[model samples]
Structure formats: structure tokens, C-alpha cells
Target chain A: MADLPERVEIAEEGPREGFQIEPGPIPTADKVALIDALSATGLRHIQVCSFVNPKLVPGWADAEAVAAGFSPRGGVRYAALWFNENGLKRALAFRDRLSITGSVSLSASDAFSVKNLNRDHAANLDAMRRMTAVHKAAGVPVTRVGVMAAFGCNYQGDILPEQVVRTVADGLAVAQEAGETIADVSLADTMGWATPTRIERGVGAVRERWPHLRIGLHLHDTRGLAVANAHAGLRLGVDRFDSTVGGLGGCPFAGQKGAAGNICTEELVLLCEEMGVRTGVDLDALIEVGRMAERIVGHALPSELLRAGSLDAFRRKQAA
Target chain B: MADLPERVEIAEEGPREGFQIEPGPIPTADKVALIDALSATGLRHIQVCSFVNPKLVPGWADAEAVAAGFSPRGGVRYAALWFNENGLKRALAFRDRLSITGSVSLSASDAFSVKNLNRDHAANLDAMRRMTAVHKAAGVPVTRVGVMAAFGCNYQGDILPEQVVRTVADGLAVAQEAGETIADVSLADTMGWATPTRIERGVGAVRERWPHLRIGLHLHDTRGLAVANAHAGLRLGVDRFDSTVGGLGGCPFAGQKGAAGNICTEELVLLCEEMGVRTGVDLDALIEVGRMAERIVGHALPSELLRAGSLDAFRRKQAA
Candidate 1:
């Protein structure tokens, strides 16, 4: 009980994740509206856009437009995800507008690294080294180490705690060689294969090995256990999480199976607030944004709270 | 860790919950087919149908047809829900095939009792007393006491632990006065207002008061925290749960927001199996049944596992 954190930081990734996955030629103006609305929801960290090749991810082909259009709120850090120098250079164009910290992202499963990144774990470390050097030369701080498929993988089966430890160790070693001071390490359940037990073991291993570094969880609700997994993280004293409003980025609940988006930001905020943990988020306002995201996407996203509403909303009604 | 149950029972309530809520005149054959298919998936307890007034729940108008239609498998207990003596008499007609034990049902929230049950707590207790005597007269055992809105209520706001204990005690008193030996108590998150912390405190308080009685959770995902609340129950070693296949009773994901179904049966199975708790359920078979339910309902249900496939299914694919 004492392990629960006093407050947690929920980083919003709806725009970056949702636009990248939706198979729509969504108007750039709507994308900008989403970012602007999320900004007003008291979310401090919002990933605004993904700077990827337009030819491959046509949904986000107008990443530059979305990057340039939204009104950024003060005290909120707007981020852009880029895989290579090309994307980073494009992001550098908006250096004054975006909070551009670089992350040394690696995959815990060698098979997932080979399948997703087209590189093995060793090769991926080399790539990270090069990317770290690029960020250092460009005066961008690379202070967060991220591990994809940290819980389990589609290509590789169940991931062990020792495997998670070795992956984070590799990322930290890379940072050491690059003279980068890593402030936090984030674990991504890229395949939606995490259970509460796995979260306890995986996060426990990382924390035991690196007690000084802050731990973050990036969970996917591929199998409807994201909320449970988040509760497990909260119980373990993890205070940082990355989520998407309306569970954006995964296949819409009605469209397909097997791919679920990130944990709905409003749901996570509701869970935290109900447990008396300060989330710094107005859950009702966030739920409204979730509804707005659903409207923009032209589908019902996988957020139950967006439909039923926050408990407090009902409480207020009852009080009235 | 020691508190986790080694094995748990997940009772399927899809056909009853889903049909009652779905606007469709879902075919009687489809309801029977769902029940039959779920029996094959190793779920021991299946709520086959609801014997309510046809005008009130037209969806379950053919409860008798479903009750008599499905082939009841050995080792599986088919159950039916009813409210008044008429509904109980309807269920009694199929007593040869259905599990005929009765439950003394009450609501913890006075506001919910008045709004939902159309009676105050004191009045409702009198109604339950009459119902218990009716069950006793019919040679039926009233062994379970169910408290709805046991966690919180939309009309009444938060529910205190002591309130839950009082509600259960009232139900138990009604049963004892009628010579009923209650064996278990179920605390329902009737309005989807329960959190993990509440589950712990509520269930914990009940266990402290009645250590001999088995505790069951009947949770709703109306607010998307059902799985987390279930986990909280598992942590407290509460071994029984009531869930719906494909999240049957709740509103469809894309159709509406707040009125989501029960904690998904497959998701609960996945959680239990992943945590090394025995559920005796074939998860892949259950997922297939969930898909079939979607096909019958002609829409997507709120189960992410129904789409993402189970971890074992992927494991098999990876192995193959």
C-alpha cells in the first residue's frame, strides 16, 4: 500500500500514435485540433507528431503540418518521434516549437528487433550509438532509455525478468559511452503481452538493478488488461506512463482484433484519481477530449469512460 | 503472493446479460447455441437465460425456449435468473435441467434500491424475505446472498465498506429467518463504480466480518476498471467471479460509451491463467466462442482478447 506513488505523470501519445495508425486522409486541421484540445487537458507530456517517411505512413504524411499547426501550451512538453536523421532534421526545423529530447530506444527481444527494426539487438545498439551521437552533436539531450517489447513479444514468446535487465543494461552502457546522463528508463509492452505478474517481475528487475533511475511503463491494451497492468505498475510505485487518449494508434475495436491501442489516458487518470493518487488531470475534461478524438477518427475508440463518463460526473449529478 | 487463489471459478453470464440488454430480437436458437458452445469451453457455471416479464426484457422473451433447447452437458451447471414468484415458477418448470439454487438479492445503496429495485432497503428486505420463503417452499436452497451496488452507485455516489457489510447482513438475516443456510456472498459493482482500492477495502471488510463465507465479485466494466478490480479480488484470494463472454451484456464498443458489459470472461480467464491461477477454461476455445457471439450479435463486443487472440494462440502460431 505504501508503495503507491503520491503522483504520476501520464504522457499523452494520441496524436502521434492515432494518426500513424488510422487509415484515413484525416484533415491536418483536425489533427491540430486534437493536439490543441489534449493540451488543455492538463497533460504535461504530449507526443504531437511522428516524423516518419510520408510514403510509408501516408496517414501521417502531413506530420509537418500537424507539427506546425497546434497551439502549444506552456508547461507542456510537446514531443515528436523520429527514427532517423531525416526525421530528426525535419523535427529540428521546429526546434523552437517542440520539446525535442532524444530517446535511445531498443527492443528487449532480439527477434522483435530483427522483425520491427530490421536489426538484431547488437545491431540495434550500434544504431542507438550513432543516433545518440547525432543528438549530442545537435545539442539535443538523449536522457531517456526506452525498451520496446520489454514485457513479451509476438516474434519472441514470454520475456524473462533477466532479459529485461540485460536490455536496460545495454541501453545504459550505450549512454555511458556517449556521456549521456539518463534520467529515466521506460518499458514498452509493444505486443500487448504484459500481465500484472509480468509487470511486477519486469519492472521489479529493472528497478532492482537501477534504483536511481525513474521507471515508466508504456502499455498496450491488445488483450484488455492494460488497466490491470497499469494498476500493477502503480502498486510498484511507478510514476511515469505513456498513453493515448481514446486508446488511439491500435486498430479500432470494431475494425479488427489482435491490435489494441495504448491505454486510454482518461481511463488511466480515472484509475489513479480513484485510488487517491494525484494525476494532475481533470478526468472529465480528458474524457471530453477522448470523445473529440473519437469524432475526429470517425469511430468509437476503446475507452469505456468516454461513453459512461467519470464517476465524479455521476456524483455531481447525484449531489445536484 | 500467498493470498492468490490456486484455482477460481468464472461463471459465464453472456447469454443472459447480453440478450437482456441487446435491442435485437436475438434468435432463441442463437442463445441456446451460445450456451452450448460455452459449455464445451470448460466453463462450469453458465447462466443460460433470464425468466423476466417479456414486456420488460423482450430480448429474453424466449428464456423458456433457450432453457429447454440447449443440451446440458455433464459437469456443467446451467442456471436461470428470475425476480418474482412468476419468474421463479418459470425457472422451476425447467428445474430438471437448470441449477435451481436461489439467491437473496439486495442493494447496498438506498438510492439505488429505490431507483433500480423500486423499493427502499427496508422494503426490499421484506420483498427478499418473501422471495426466500417462496424458494424454501419450492424445495430450492437459498445459499447465496447478492448485494448490488455493493461498491458504489451512480445515484448514491460512494458506498462505504460498512454499508456493504450491513447490506449482506440484512440479506443473510432474511435467509436465516427463512431457514436458509447461506454459503457465499457476492458483492456487485452494479453501476461500474468500483476501483481496486475499493475492492480491497470492501472485500477485506466483508471477509473480516464473515471469514467463513466465500466471497465472489460481480464486476462491470462500465468505467473500464473491471479487470483491475478483478485483480484486486484475486489478490485478496476471492475465488469466484461472474463474467460475460465477449462482454455480452454491456453496450457495444462503437455503439455507445458508458453502458459497457460485465468484466469480459475471456479477459478474466487470460488474467487468471497468466497469473498461474487455474481457471479450467480453454481460452482459445472461449475466444472462438466470443467471435461467434459477435457474429450472432452482428457487431463487435468489448473484448480486446476476442480480437488479439490469446497468448497461447500466438505461442502455437510461433511454434508452428
Candidate 2:
């Protein structure tokens, strides 16, 4: 195997992406406690919540309350996801305390784009430009655009590499037109269709085209290839990844009835640590947080690491 | 990333390795039917059964019956596991019909060897030498010695690469003393403690010391790194792997009930195929066989592909 990177960044989005999908609302206090527990686990960045329509995703209705209830740690950076003008307005309310993250989603499947965002590529691009302007005015140094369905899609199967490249390029152009820098480009495998080959080729294409942009992967473990694809991205020198505690949060649009969720944070950390790639997160603590997440969500989780204790822990027990 | 091998050889050991640990006996006819189903799925090699004490592993009491009942396909090879004199005696009864495999266990933790095999290193080495002589006398072209617990053991925490190298060397010496050739040396991660770095380094060390011997991996998905470890092995150009259909079976010694089974055959195939490494097994047929195995086992299996369906199938549905 090739030499792995010295360290990789794991951006936890469980509170936002994970909680937003549940049909039942999670109490703001519980969300704060979960985020606080995750913060102590050595995660550097946490996407705290999403500023969105309460009517559409009532689960995230307590986003402002969650932000207000949570305690911010010294070293950790808290982020929030916002999609449009209204979401940005909500995000701006807590801009003093939160590092804002706005996504300009380019849905390869027009049907998904219309259903999820009620907008097509051109409309979303225009919204992205306006969002970039708002962030620029707010002096937010980095603007992140999530390329939703960057891989394949439920409605539109087999999203070509060119489509991703074009979407990313267009997204960047809009950001640049608004005189804002594209700080992070996240290739969101919204339906968990990001295969290793697809990941490697997509990352390679994006890297070749825009070498300076920080690339991140928002992968779903619906097909159980999330870690494998992450490794593929790591092979291509992509370091940042978005994962959720306990593999929480499913894409309602992914069409798999909650089986598709962000890759498990602890599992991803385990994979990285096993490969000799550093992921400064404390695995044991992260697993505790995963358990807390399972309890908060009122169901069993899909994290293999959470179920099967870490090898180190097992080894320590055997030694004792 | 390094170039993957043009193709990989998947040796299915579900019948022997997967069924042996089950408490209830799988009917001989069902075993034969499963093998027959696997045979038609384009799997080139299948480890049909083990010739061991039925009292110890009643699951395999029908080994002979399973072998006799199943119809072997034209392009497939059948193999069986043999431990000592008794197993060899049983295996030799059908020597013309099956390729025989034995294990030279190196339990980093001595307690595991005692619990699983009822022998220490020196005693197993003596048995290995005797087994090699028997195979040599029978003119078996290849003698395979699986290095059990080559990765780590439940009793013994971590097995170092040096220990694995030493075990392989000692096993080779025994085969050489018997005037026999060791055709294959498999590093068996019985407890699924193997990580990617360990796999690459271990495989690399084995390749460096004995370049001629074919190296294979017998990995378990206990810790969910089996596929990742397989990818790591692939990056080092190791092409042969042992997998079980529907991810059935578990190591009684693995201490996790049924969580640590041989890497799922369809999952492994999917990983390889997605990485552009060829596996001759027919995936759809294997998935159907996986469903059959699940039904025969009277429970839901852990195979992700079987649950999520294949990308091609999903794409076809979407296109339709």
C-alpha cells in the first residue's frame, strides 16, 4: 500500500445532518448534550445544526434552540448548514458564535433537485451566488458548496464524472462571481452511490481542475462502501470527510428508508487510525458518544465499531 | 494509489468455514444444495467441508455425505480442510476428488491454540510435518498451511508481523523436511483484528521472504475492516482471498457470537469489481445463493449487497 497521509480531518455532522432526518423531533437539550459530548471526543469541526424550513423538516425546528443550549469548547469549531436566503438569515443570527457553512447544492437528478430544493441548477446557482454575497458581506472566510448527488442518484442513476466536474466548476464560478473564495467543495454521495472507482476518478478530476480548493466527502454507508470510498479519496490525497455519530441521519430522498446515512464517525476514525493515518479523535470517547446518539435517537445504530468494541479495547481487556 | 491486480481469485469457504461453528446441523442435502448452487454461480474454488471430529463440530458430521451428494461443475475445484491423521484419512478417501488444506496455527496468545486446536506451536509444527509427509506420499501437488491467528487472537492480543514471518518460515521448513512444497500460505485473521497497515506490512513481509509461494488472506469482518484490509492486500498485489456466502458463520473463539464471519463473498466481490479488479464469480447469482443461504440458516444474513441490492440492479430499476 502507498504511504498514507499524516493526518485526516473528520468533520462531524451528526447533530445537523443526522437529526434533521428523523420523523420525531429531538429535544434541543438532547441535541446540545450530544454535540457537547462529541466536542470532548477531539472532533475539531462539528456541524451543529441546519437552518431550514421547520415545516419541511420539523425535526430541525429546534436548530436555534440547540445552538443556544450548547456550550462551545475552546479548540472546536462549530458549523451550521444553510441553503438559501431564509436559512442564511437564520444562520446569521448566530454568526457571532458559529462558523457558518452554506451549501449550494447541484443535484444531478433534476427530479431530486426539484423535490428537495424546489429549484433547478440555474436557480440554485443564482441562489448560490446570492448566498456567497451574503457570506462575503458577513466576512465568513470560507464558503462551502455541497455537490448533492455528485455521484449517482436515486432518480437519475449513474451520475457521470463530467456532471460532477461541471457542477463543481459552475458552483465555483458563482462563488467567484460574488467575489468569494470556494473554501471547501463537498462531494455529497446523497444516495450512497459513490463507489471507490467513482470516488477516485471524481476526486482526481476535481483535483486536476481546481488544485487549491479543499475537498471533502459527505458519504452515506447505505451500500457499506463509505469507508472503502473514503480510503479511495484518501489515496487521491483528499483529507476532509463529513461523518455522523452512530451513522445517524438518512436522506429522505435517497429512497432507502433511512438505511442510507452519513458514514459513521467512529468507524471512519477507526479506519483512518488502522491505516496509520492520524485522526486525533479519541475512539473510545467517540464510541461513547455513538452510544449516547443511539439512545437519543431511540434506536439501534449501524456503526460496526460501536457494536464491536475497538481492537485496542479488546486487546487491553485480554491483557488484563 | 498503486495499480490493482488485473484479477483476483476468491475461494469460497462458506460450506466448511461458515457452517462448522453453527450449533444446529445443516442438513447434508442442504449443504450439498448450497454447494451446488455456489458451483453454478461461477465460483472457481469452493472449500466443501472439513474432515474433523463430528463430536467437536457436529455441523460438519455430514462432510462425506455433502461431498458425495453434490455434483461438482466442470470448471470448479472442490477443497476440504484436514487437521491431523484422522482428517487426512477421511480426506484421502476422496483424495482424487478434493484438494486438502491444513493449518499451522501461531496463536500470539497461547490460550487460543489450547482452546481451539488443543495443541501448542511445537506440537502443531510436528503435526504439520507429518501432514506434509502424508500429502507428499499421496503426491498431493500442493500443500496449503493456513497460519491461524496470523493477525491477532482473542486470547493473544496482537500477533506481530515478525511472528507471522517466523510461523510461515517454520511451516515451510516442516514441508521442506517432508520433501514437500508449500504451494500456499494463508494468513488467517481468525479474530478479525487485522488492520490495513498490518495487512500490507504482513503481506509485504511474506512476499519479501518467500516470493514464490502464493499468499492468500482469510479475513473476518468482526471489526468491519475485512474489506478495507482486502483492499490494502490488493494494493500490495495479493490476489487470493477466502470468503463466505451471505457472510454466514462465525468463529466460536472470536467471542462475538456471529459478528465475525468470513468476509462476505458478495460484498468482497462487489468491492473488487468496483475497484476494477476482476472476480470470475457471478454477483447476481451469488446474491441469489446468498438469499438461499440466509433462508437455510433461518435468519437474516449480514451481507450489505443482499440487503441494498446491487448498483446495477438499482440503476436498471431507475432506468426502467
Candidate 3:
């Protein structure tokens, strides 16, 4: 309890995550509407769109339109995702609207790196070095290191906490050689193989080694244990999370169909608020945004809170 | 980690919990099949069906047929749920196959008692007393005290740890007056108002007061924190749990439609098995049964593990 944070910083990835895999041209205006609705909630950070090849990810072909379309609210930092130089250039085009920072992204498992990026750890680090140069050229500060499959990998077996620590070190080394100071590390449960014990070990190991760096968990609910994993991270004082409203996204490569996406933002808020951890996000307002996201997706995403509603609503009704 | 139990006792309630709320006249044979399948999953205890009024709960009208239908396997303790003498009489008819131990079931919230059972706390106590007498007359051992709405209530606001402790004491007192030596208590998150912190506090309070009686948790996944709460209980060494296969039930009166039910059996097994705690149940076998449950229900159930497959499955594939 003493280790839990006073508040958590949630980066909403619903717009980027949902549109990336939803198998729709999902009208660009609806996407902007959902982002606008989310902006109205007290969420201070939102990822508005993904800048990727329109041919490969047809759902996100209108990424530029979504980036420019949504009404950005003051005090909220809007971000975008991109992989290479070309994608970064597209994202930079919206510098006035998007919070343009860069990340040194690497994978802990060599197999996941090969499968997801067609590169092993060595080759991925070289790519990160080049990406770091690109960010510097574009004047984007590279301040975060995201280690994918930091908990475990589906292609590889159980991931050791040491492996995660090593991966973070490798990413930090890449940034260090480029004169970039990494302030935080985000561990991605990219394949959803994380259990609470695994989280405690993984997060514990990283925090012990990098005592000054902020740690975040980017959890996927592929196995229905995301909230538990998040709770485990919170217990260890990991104060940053990446979530999707209504659990809006799915992993295209988790080796199974119907695999769940990120942990739902509203559920995480309820968990934090119930535990006396401040989230700075309005619970009811976020829930309403979750419902709106569900409508835009034209299907129910994986959030149970969207259906059952926040406990505060019932508390209010009961008080009445 | 030292406080976590090495092994746990899971009371399988899928057949009863699922059948009661599924809006089915879900064929008695199908219900029997699910029970028979669960029986083979290494789960020791299973609640087969609820003996309730037919008109009110048309789904469980064939409770007798379901009771007489399934083949009772060796070493398995099968149980049934009942609220009054008629329901108890119906269950006693199949005492040769069912485990007939009774429970003093009461709700911590008067508002929930009134809304759910048409009685306040005091009246509900009288009803529990009457039910206890009925159990004693039938020579049934009332060995467990169950406190529903033990964590929180929708009709009444948040339930405190002290309130839960008082409710447990009230139920234990009822059993004591009837000369029923209770050995264990089960606290239910009846309306799904529990978070991990609430769980720690409630479980902490009860364990503090009794110190000798065994404690278990019956968690609903409403609002999606059931698994996290279960994890919290595991941290405190609560070794008994009640779960439904495929997350196979819904809270009909959770003041909302499409509310999720109990913590998933396979998900619980995954959480325990991954944490080095032993849950004799096989993950692959349980996931298969969860699929079978989905087929019987004619829709997807809430267990994401059903779709994602077990981590062990991926491990085997990876190893291969």
C-alpha cells in the first residue's frame, strides 16, 4: 500500500489502437468524434492516430485526416505512433496538434523481434540507432524506451525478469550513444503472457536496476489478466499506463483470432479510484466516452465496465 | 508471496450459476453434460443446479431433472443451492448423489436484502434462522456461512470492512445457536462492487476477528476487477474460491443489463497456476470445457482465456 502511487498517468490509445485493427474504413469523421469525446474527459494524454502505410493498414489510411480532424482540447497532450522516417515525417506534419516526441522501441525476445520486425535484437538496436538519428534530425526529443514483449513472448517461452532488464539496458544504451536522456521505460505485455507474479518480478527487477527511471506497463488483455497485471504493477508503484477505451484494440499477431486488445481505460480508472489513487479523470465521463467508442466501432469492445457501469453511478443513485 | 496458499479448493458453480441466469430452458441434458464435463476437469466440488420457483426462474425449473440426470463421479463433492424448505426438500430428494451441507446465507446490506429477497436485515436473519432449523431437522450439516453483498451493494452504497465482519458474525451466530459448528466462511462480492483494496480490507477484517475459520471468496466479474480481487485474496492466503466455467453467468439484478458473473474458472486457474500456487485443475481441459459451455449457451461467454487459449498451449506450440 505504501508503494502505490498518489496518481497515475494514463495515455489513451483507443483511437490509434481501434482504427488500426477494426477492419473498417470506419468513417474518418466518427474517428475524430470519438477522439473529441475522449478529449472532453479529464484524460490529459491521448494518442490520436497511427502513421503507417495505407496499403498495409487500410483501416488507418486516413490517419492524416484523423490527425487534423479531431478538436484538440487545451491541457491534453495528443500523440501519434509511427515506425520509420517516412511515418515520422507524416506525424511531424501535425506538430502543432500532436505532442511530437520519439521513443526507442525494442523487444526483449529475439524471436518476437524477428517475427514482428523481421530483425533480431542486434539488428533492431541498429534500427533504433538510425531511428534515434531521424528523431534528432526532426528535432523530436527521444525520452522514452518501450520494450515490447517485456514480460513474455508467445513464440518464445516464459521470459525471465533478467531478460527484460537486459532489453531495457539495450534500449537505454542506444539512446545514450545518441546523447538522448531516457526518462522512462514502458514494458509492453505485447503477447499478453503476463501474470501478476510475472509482473511483480518483471517490474521489480527493472525498478531495482533503473532506480531513477519511471516505469510504465502497456498491458494487453489477450488472456483476461490485464487488470490483475496492472494491479501488480501499481503495487510496485508503476505510475504510467497505456490503455484503450472499451479495450478497443486486438493484437494482429498474437497467433489467435479474437485476442483481446489493451486493458480498458475505464476499468483501470475504477481500480485506481477505488483504491484511493487519484487518476484525475472523471469516472462517469470516461465511461460515457467508452460507450461512444463502442458505438463508433459498431461492436462491443472487451470492457465489462461499459456494460455494468462505474460503481459511483450506482452510489449516486442509491444516495438519491 | 509467502502468504499465498500452495493449493486451493475451487467450488465449481458453472452449471448452477450459468443455468440460473441464461434465459434458457437450456436442456437438462445439456446442463448435465456441462456438469459431467466439469467433473472430469479435476475440480473437486461443483454446484450442479439451483432448486428455485419455476415461474420466477424458469431456467432452473428442471433442477430435479438435472440433479437426477448427471452421473456422479467418484471423489467429487457435488452440491445444489436452495433458499427455503421446498427447495431444500427437492435437493434432499437426491441426497445420495449431492453433497447436502447447508449454509447460513445472508446479505450485509438491508437494501440489497429488501431488493433481492424482499426482507430487511432483521427479517432476513429470521429467515436464515428458519432455514438453519430446516437444515438441522433434515440432518444436514450447516458447515459454511456465506455473506452476500459482503464487499458492497448497489442498492446500498459501499459496504465497510466492519459491516462485513458484523454480517459474518451474525451468520455464525445463527449457526452456533442451531449447534452447527461452522468451519469456514465465504464472502461474496454479490453486486461486483469490490476492488483489490476493498478485498484486502474486508478479508483482513474477517480474518482478524475469527483467525481460526477458513475464508473463501465468491467474486463476480461485474466491473471487471474480480480477477484482481481474487489475486488480492490469494496474497492473504484465502484458499477457497467459487467460479463459473467460461465466465458462464450474469447478475440479473446487478441494476444493469449484460452484467458479467463470477470470476472465470479457467482464468482463476491460470492466475493460480502461473503464480506457483497449485490448482489441481488442468488449464487445457478447462479451456475446452469453457468452449463446450459457449456452445451450450449459444453465444460467446465472458472468459477471454476461452478465445486466447492457455499460455501453456502457446508454450507447447513454441516448444514444438
Question: What DockQ number belongs to candidate 2?
Answer: 0.42
Shift of residue B146 alpha carbon in model 3, Å: 0.8
Q: State residue B213's C-alpha deviation in candidate 1, in Å.
A: 0.7
Give the higher-TM-score candidate: 2 or 3.
Answer: 3
List the TM values for chain B, per candidate.
0.97, 0.94, 0.98
Query: Cα deviation in Å at residue B46, candidate 3?
Result: 0.6
Candidate 1, superposed: residue stretches over 4 Å from native: A251-258, B251-258
**Candidate 2, pairs of clashing residues:** B109-B156
How much is B45 displaced in model 3, in angstroms?
0.7
- Which candidate tops DockQ? 3
The DockQ-based CAPRI class assigned to model 2 is acceptable
Angstrom error at residue B203, model 2: 0.9
Top-TM-score structure, candidate number? 3
Count of backbone clashes for each model? Answer: 9, 1, 0
Q: lDDT, candidate 2, residue B259?
A: 61
DockQ of 1: 0.65
Tens-digit lDDT track of model 3 for A210-314: 899999999999889999999999999899999999999987876668989999999999999999899899989999999988888889889999899988899
Provide DockQ values for all models, in the order shown.
0.65, 0.42, 0.86
Predicted model with the maximum lDDT: 3
